[model samples]
Target: MPQPGATSRILVTGGAGFIGSHFVRSLFSGAYPGLAGSRVTVLDKLTYAGNPANLDPVRDQPGFAFVEGDITDAGLVDSLLADHDAVVHFAAESHVDRSITGAADFVVTNVVGTQTLLDAAHRREIGPFVHVSTDEVYGSIAEGSWPETDPLAPNSPYSASKASSDLIALAYHRTHGLDVRVTRCSNNYGPYQFPEKVIPLFITNLLDGGKVPLYGDGLNIRDWLHVDDHCQGIALVLEKGRAGEVYNIGGGTEITNKELTDRLLSACGATWDSVDYVEDRKGHDRRYSVDWRKINAELGYEPRHDFESGLAETVAWYRDNRAWWEPLKQRAGLA
Candidate 1:
């Protein structure tokens, strides 16, 4: 793929968002061993969830550039792919609640946008196109973890769009012989995440001395993968994974919403009185777990962050980075 051992120029779509930004920052920081000499160009639309501030740390570094644009624009995507060595696509409208209210945006951005990128990458012969996806594509699981082969039964508009994109990415590999590697990862929690997500929403709400909302009985379970660990797993796939294969990246930790709420309450020194039980989200998946043995056995990939410590650090980050997140929350009416 990446010209065997040559230095690569990578195009990172949605690179200003939570997980994507972490991958770009890590690449510049030399965290990804095989990508020490990599040059990165970030293409992001800077939507409400995409913040330029997330890339501020790496902005001054050499071999790093940023472009503001939509992935659905074929002309722009084709022009951008002219120079890049590979693509790590993280672009999508990913909030489940928002997707439920209106699925059009998710359909256009996640499905159409992905098709646009794939078509361009295919034409340009871009190797090792890594499609960053979610475990929610597997839908609710009553028991046992889902392997990559499990049928995709997405329950929400958000997940369905992602599932569609995942298939499109893999299809390019099969039909056009494009180098597409797809990774479905567990729920991610870490810094720079938009406050709309559960962890950030709860942490930020409690920090403001406000009530935190817990849906239904708060028994829904999820595997929490830290952003850094997720980025590392993505790097391993981009570097060593085979084309047309799917990998499941997980945090190796499982917890229910109630347990997670308890941890958050303890972390912020807040009481259960601050917890407000909200109505359940529409078509909310009961549980999600992924079998990541393939990534481990093949690429030596493993999550480096333990859930407890990772959550602590994440809460501390939000506590310390108020100025960075406050404006975002206010703009999005989340404050």
Candidate 2:
């Protein structure tokens, strides 16, 4: 906890990525009231998914700073961890398809890098360490949603690495009494998301008059939480959550790929023909959903925007804010 009238330095790892960048933005925007006395330090490697432009808007803000570094560098992490009151770990190799092609990167970064951070936290930083995780760690579910205590049954290499990190984090908390709080959030969609992800990939394709690729008959269901809502859940855990507990954050709406593609068409003024169904990638999970009762009951949390409204808002952002995303598209050859 931060002392009153003192600016708590909040160190965020992988802070340039999708959800991590949003959390960085939310903190400076006063979205977390308890963090009024907080400053931010983002340590990121600026990988393909890590965009410095996302944080460019807040770079000049008095309380914000950034460094280009890898979390696997234990010496560097330890040196940096010595200065903060909290650690929000959002850095990971998150794409499942990419993981199938290259499991080694996932294991190295998601597993080894996280262990490096946890070791640093236990050795140097006694502040709250919020591990940002994904619901994929619970693997696939045929029907009912997964609670936090559910067994780890990750299917993809990406999810397997995340599960390994979660286990390491939990052990550090239980064995060493380090303050560790974990959050497993559902699929996230919003502005500044990399185009490789489903929503952005399809939306950018639609905007560019190209076909939107639909994987595996487009029936896989996912719970889409806006990045803002995810950032809110993370802040709550860091501020008010008890150590050694897991919380689930969700978007609260279940939509299959086909249904979501239809909605995206409506938003983008495109049609079903614009979607080109493609072969499913290896290890694509059938469905992912989170039961958010724990976060709501424990932290008084509620997502601010509903799916429909957020979808429209996100579409509009991509349309109007092309200046922000266009360069990224060009660099990625999506243009």
Which structure among the candidates has the greatest TM-score? 1
Compared with the true structure, all predictions reach lDDT values of 0.95, 0.88
Q: Taking the tens digit of each residue's C-alpha lDDT, what string does model 1 give over 1-335?
A: 45523379999999999999999999889898788888899999999999999999999999899999999999999999999979999999999999999999999999999999999998899998999999999999999999999999999999999999999999999999999999999999999999999999999999999999999999999999999999999999998999999999999999999999999999999999999999999998999999999999999998999999999999999999999989999999998
Cα deviation of 146, candidate 1, in Å: 0.4
Q: Would you estimate the TM-scores of all the predictions?
A: 0.99, 0.97
Candidate 1 has which clashing residue pairs, if any? none
Cα misplacement distance, residue 157 of candidate 1 (Å): 0.4
TM-score result, candidate 1: 0.99
Best lDDT goes to which candidate? 1
What is residue 154's positional error in candidate 1, in angstroms? 0.4
Window of ten residues with lowest summed lDDT in model 2: 1-10
Predict model 2's lDDT versus the native.
0.88
